[model samples]
Target: MTRTKLLAKIRQVFPGHDPEDVQRVLDEYAGPERLRVHLAILKLCDEDRRDSPRHYVDSACQDHRDVLAWAESPQQLRPDWFSLSVTERAKVAKADRQQYARWLAR
Candidate 1:
């Protein structure tokens, strides 16, 4: 998504938070590839359960290790991850796979 859309989504997801701080948090934690993965997950969740983005963000913030664990699972099992465009999926998948591999190496 474009920066404007992303900023808008961030604003919607984190109501009451300062927009600049929200952007900084997104940049620090989400980055590009992770943000794509998160957006895909949010989109799928919207279709299935209609949970607010805050729910996912809160969960991630509460226990990031669990989020990493979930990402380490087979991508084929995550329809939301797969729902991403092929290029986007490749970017997110490759980045996450490398991150998980590094964690394993450590």
Candidate 2:
């Protein structure tokens, strides 16, 4: 459950996706759950608003509430969230949680 392993898993899950923004999340985090929440949240946020094939939240957020709520859900997910080690956390989060659900379907 180290950061390196977690990052590798993330890359596997999102082969072509950029890690820069996700890296931002990792830098702020002390451990794996933070990484889990970030990837889960990022996937959720990106999926909710897919104007393109890429997986990033709109750089220009005309609608912020959806992403905010999506962010909030992770707080509730912490108990189950904490159980996951840095390694399994992302796999669990990415598979179970469909992040983009919070956003408005355009």
Top candidate, metric TM-score: 1
Q: Which runs in model 2 stand beyond 4 Å of their true positions?
A: 17-21, 25-33, 45-106
Question: Candidate 2 lDDT, tens digit per residue, 3-100?
Answer: 66555644654557665545654344333344444444445544454322223334213244444445545443556777668767766566444533
Error of 1 at 40 (Å): 5.1
Clashing pairs in 1: none
Q: Which stretches in model 1 have alpha-carbon errors above 4 Å?
A: 30-35, 38-106
- Residue-wise C-alpha lDDT for candidate 1, range 52-85, written one tens digit per residue: 4454455566665444445454463466875788
Model 1's lDDT to the true fold? 0.53
Alpha-carbon shift of residue 63 in model 2 (angstroms): 16
Q: Clashes in each model (backbone N, CA, C under 3 Å)?
A: 0, 3
lDDT of each: 0.53, 0.47
How high is the lDDT of residue 61 in model 1?
Answer: 66
In angstroms, give how far residue 97 of model 1 lies from its true place.
21
